[model samples]
Target: MKKSILAIAVIVTLAFTSCTDDNNPSTPKSTFELKIDDLKGDITDGTVTLDPSQTYTLTGALIVKSGATLTIPAGTTIKTSTTALNTSLYIGVERGATININGEANNPVVMTSGQAAPKESDWGGLVICGDAKVNTGDNGTSEVGGLSFGGNNNADSSGKINFLRIEYTGAKFSSDKEFNGVSFFGVGSGTEVSNIYAFESGDDGIEFFGGAVNASNLVIVNAYDDSLDFADGYQGTITNVYISGVSKAGIEGSNNQGNDIATPMTDAKLINVSIVKGADAKFTAGEQAINFKEGGGKQTYTNLFVSGIDTFAKLDTGSGATARIDAGDFKVNGKNFVSTSNLTTDYVSTETGAGNGATLPTWATKISKNN
Candidate 1:
């Protein structure tokens, strides 16, 4: 009887399964638990709402094209195949598309690997592309998907993502193009992003490339590379972030790769950040907690707490970065800009208090206990 019931469920899944590259009504719409298998296409101009009570499998790239939306309710679980080749299993929302993840603090949406003992690089992670401002060009190609992004609108809206957890992701597309836990490419200020957690990512936990989207209440644990990375003329604000057990820098910032003096230079402000390296951390010989390289950007750090790291801040001398430090363009610890030579001696292993009255969110308290 049990075998018969399982067989019936498999038949129902196959009967309703539909896979296509273009927009059409032939796609499956099932209210019951749906098993998406080997789906190698796009969801164009349509909507896919996952049931919170059911579990879904993603075996290939699930691209939400223009005018499409993918909605995940609270307490939803979406697992990606670990055996997929060449970073196949991932989610990509293109320009004009939206992904509404309405997860609550107690019932957050979870996206993880399908393997039993999941390790790093199990699958590709989430990718969001928007038509916001970027120094790369009008329509620059993204590093992971080669999708076109970037425009003149600084207020472009991709959608909302809240109370989400991504685990064991960051599959490499190529030697130089590896996916982050969450990649925001040219995303804008109109989008709402908060309460995100990335765990055990093979690459960076979160990366913003040429975007103006502000984020808050972020947590990263056991990241193989930098926990947070900002590049390509990003002009966003980050608040209340915590990073632990990072192999590389806790925060890595850079301007445009091609043109160092690009318009809207990477001017990001970080508040109430804490980077703690555990006893068994995997840091390199000369790794720092904050590293700014390939400059022509302005960075402001306030009320930061960094401990158990070899170096606190490492600012590259090229690209006039040292000049920016002297000109008060980069502020540290609520003080005027100063030299980077004393950053380690001044800030490393120090217990700097929180920013003003900043406090960690409730969700962060629950997640930090596990790390």
Candidate 2:
């Protein structure tokens, strides 16, 4: 009877221990890696709305195909992968695709690099291509993506972008093909772009490649290249632009590479612009505020204010560009055009008795002025 009782007690103790062990395991549970759908491939033929609650990662080139629309709500933050030097993570809207960025002033849509230490050219930037007019030919190939753009339609609509900010963009693809912060490839006037800002772009802040899109309330800060670059017969009108701390010219204009005398020239008109050089800028001795390379189009500059720069305007050695300026094709109302040879290292102000009676934009109260 004693042996039986001892065996029963041992069994009971073992059972209780087993139950306790089964209830609470000693080894911790393994955590599965959180996976998300990577937005790196083509978005073909559908309307995809990005949820503001969830974060999306861009690994490679995200192409919005023709006849598709990518709708991004307000306060949507897109993070890019930082695995390599040239990750080429970008959002490209094709010729017929549409991108509706409905961001408010308080909650602006931000597309930035995912690198822990973000810098310029960390990844590619935003690209929008449309069927607008261009001088490169009928649907010419874009320099950045080799995409086709340009058509007979001057009012083509790719989409609308408002209250959007792009940071640390302008990844270089090749020796000659470098991306910009925002590249408008044949975008038309029907596209509404306003309240846009580009910060620390490795290349140009905003580049228009043969488009008729009109932009307003644009701001560019610390762009390594030109602040605003218009080339390949861009005929857009810009109003109330602010550029600060640019490495290259504030505005660079060119008609076409092959033929500077190309039709549908880059005839952009600037109404109110302010360009201020940064304190840490290393501008060369002969750099111009505005550089008109080759045979640039008949652009007009009005109500311009520039400071902290040595030179004013540099017109390249082209007879076509000079003749156009002389014939009032390239008109200047509040500022005088300074060629490369006659560039002065003196600060010129439009508000302080310089050229015609032009004043700063009423909305540009935040910008610092020497006048």
Candidate 1: clashing pairs of residues: none
Model 1 CA deviation exceeding 4 Å by range: 1-40, 345-362, 366-371
Best by TM-score: 1
lDDT of 1 by residue, 1-371 (tens): 99999999998786666443245546335322335554446877667887888777888888888888788898888887656673888889898888899988767888888898888889889999999998787798878877778998889999999989898988986668899999999999999999888988889999999989999989887788888999888988898888877688888888867766677888999988878765573655145777777774888887778767756677777755766667777777867655556666346345442332223445485434242
Q: Highest lDDT: which candidate?
A: 1
lDDT of 1 at 245: 77
Task: Provide the lDDT at 327 for model 1.
Answer: 76
| TM-score for each of the candidates | 0.85, 0.82
Write model 2 residue lDDT over 1-371, tens digit each, in one string: 99999999999999889778866755322122222446677777667777887777878787777887888888888888868455368889889888999877667788888889998899889999999989987677767766678887889998899878888998987657888889999999999998777887888899998889999878777788888899888988888788777688888888877887889878888877777776773643134578887687778877677777766787767776876776667655543464534434343453321122123344333321211
Residues forming the 10-long window of minimal summed lDDT in candidate 2:
27-36
Q: How well does candidate 2 match the true structure in TM-score terms?
A: 0.82
- The local lDDT score (0 to 100) that residue 284 gets in candidate 1 is 57
The CA lDDT at 232 in model 1 is: 85
